[model samples]
Target: MSALQAVAKTSAPTPEYYFQEARAFFDAFKASQAIISYRKSLLMTPAAPQALNNLRLLEQSIGRMPDGVKSATRACVLEPGNTALQHGLTDALLSAGEIEHGQARNFWRHLKPEILIIRQGLPEEWNGGPCRDGQSLLICHEQGIGDEIRFASCIPDIQKRFGGPVILESDKRLATLFARSFPGLTVVEKVQRSDSNPPTAQYRPLVEEHGIGRYIMLADLQSFVRPSLEAFPRTAGYLTPDVTETRHWKDHFRATGKQPAVGLSWRSGMRRAGARHNYPELQDIVPFLKGADFLPVCLQYDMSSSERTAIQKASTKQLYIPAGIDQRNELDRVAAMIAALDLVISPNTSVLMIAGAVATPSIGLHSERGATFLGAKTDPWFPEECSLIKSGDGSWSALINEAIPYLTRMLSKGGRLK
Candidate 1:
């Protein structure tokens, strides 16, 4: 064959080639590379539905909700009949704080394994027409402890909108706290095992005995009530801690010589999908503990006796944990202890939400991923008392070092930002 003929026979790489490479990168956990490959594929074939959908998944996983929404919209437009694609678009929209878009209705359908019903699908109300006043409603659980708390912020709004007997199933840890917080609502404790479905015993009797028929996923209230930024009430928190327990902890800590007290929670229990980037190791926070002069209290859940010792050994500071309080199982007590602290420093987990909700000064260490930001640095659900440290594209080591001065100032103010 002639050299010219041989050269003409050579072909360029197709968009499908790049798309497959992107998928490989995604499976390998090379998020940056996967994104690059997906973009490259799209550049070659702009109408590629799979590429757009996967890109949306990647973006949303990493907390880039706005970009995720854009990609999801494109993919949905290309494949209108695709329920998966439609659900992806809806999920991205909700995560991006588009609460007013009416996407929360079908949201539970998109959960992993894509199941939201407890035993069977309960009759849905809000999606149809004007919900009658005082109708019985069963609100079921979804996701983790932190999400449950974050979603509960809308319960107050739900109460105002619907004059019904509302039965809410919660994590056992949060049951006491939720019952105390919302007076009229019936709160039931249902411990959901990751390996199994939500326990029926925890909710069925209360639901049936109370004559509750219509239901909604607790988070679904986001669209009906907290649909706009303005709808979020400026309050300390919806979950109220036991004032007596709060006082007890405050006195207990005071007898330990009453220094500027700061509560610390470094991690969450579950292995969230593609979103575990910023929780620091116990040893990583040693620098924050060094010379801060404030007493460091352990707010982290499920700490072993060894890990507790490790915390003090790592920070070279004494760690204070109240007697008879289980940080994980007793979330209500955890809230009381959090209230007793002058400040709480944690990753964006349930403890952090507890701090913010209780009006305690908190420094939430975050990597800029979450719908809670509502397209801004601060979470609207939290009061000004809870300040968020927004970090991006950096190691937790660097993020903590950067926060040292701010931490010093906050302590100097005796844990008040003002």
Candidate 2:
């Protein structure tokens, strides 16, 4: 046979082929691509429970929780007796924030078997260990840089328990900051780790390789015990600005007016594909702040003077550019400046989180993806007094409309502009 005919003759179209390709794509973190392949597999075999579960997980990873819940529900229906599918559906429902009283109870009842198995395996004297025992505990940082900063507070607590050194694996950009933030703890850049220690991996791999003994995922530390932000040590005045640099920006913003000057950041890190969709265009917010004395504090990195000028031309109020402020190196200084301001209006970003940490009043703009998980009120991670405005139906205009009232409220409360 000819090469094409020979290949056609030898090859078979099977559900397993598509399912395996979907699995490969998922393992490689190509969630959208995996969804396509998993859908194809499901088409070929209408009742593949594993393929449905994979689709559900892929949808969740890409911030499509509603779709994930639907897929997970379908998977459960296909195999009502499957424990894994049941668990997957429960997780999807919980993460989607749709669990009612009956649904919550049902989820716990279904999860009881697995819970019992784990509880039965635990040692009676699990807590009876030496303070300085040489147990190797690996701590992995999950989510964004702000989350790392928030949760790194647990390292000292972990050190108190284990007494031995705790290896922290985190994002490369955050290595220096985390090292400085948590002194005396071993902070490993996830990308640069040597083979002597297992090379940095995701949460599942790290947990699996470390055998899950005496290890804590940084994200779970808050939930593993009774909930309280008090578990974290409150280091008063943690972020400070350069005195010389601070005076310069203070004077510039003060030059604008006697009115309470509000600092604004409507953008976040543009590294991810979804960031573009989530962040509102700067012009959208300009029309809403008509009478208020606002100062554009451009927290976005890589922005030029021309961009600032463009934004100012769009705004009714004059924009203030601080001298000697570089977004990359001067994050601490920018945060300090934000603290000095009467109020800050920002999108969900590390800067907003920093402002919250400093107890600065802020109006936070949240997109549907963010708002759906984090509620309409104040964030639990930050101060309760800060206002949250949601992007209704995930539109930019909705965010701007919601922000107007909060901005007006902040302006009503008088304080120093700079």
Cα lDDT, all candidates: 0.73, 0.58
Q: lDDT of candidate 2 vs native?
A: 0.58
- Decoy 2 TM-score against native: 0.58
Clashing pairs in 2: none
- Candidate 1: which stretches are off by over 4 Å? 1-34, 41-54, 57-65, 75-88, 95-97, 102-111, 127-134, 191-207, 272-278, 304-313, 385-392
TM-scores of the candidates in the order shown: 0.80, 0.58
Candidate 2's residue-wise lDDT over 74-160, tens digit each? 998998887777877766765465534213323333243423212111112223243334544666555566666555545656666
lDDT of 1 at 385: 49
Question: Per-residue CA lDDT of candidate 1, range 1-418, in tens?
Answer: 1432344358565687677777766654465677887899899999888789999877865667889999999998998877777777776776687765635445535443544334543455455233465567777777678888888988866776677677787887888888999989888766333445542324445555767667777767776776677877776667799999999999988888858778887887665664445467667677878847887887866767888888667766877776787777888888898888988888888888888878788887875545555554467778644444433334567777877777888888877666
In model 2, the runs with Cα more than 4 Å from the true position are 1-130, 134-138, 153-215, 225-252, 255-257, 288-291, 304-306, 369-377, 384-394, 414-418
Q: What are the RMSDs of all candidates, in order? A: 5.9, 11.0
Q: In model 2, where is the ten-residue run with the lowest total lDDT?
A: 116-125
* Candidate with best TM-score: 1
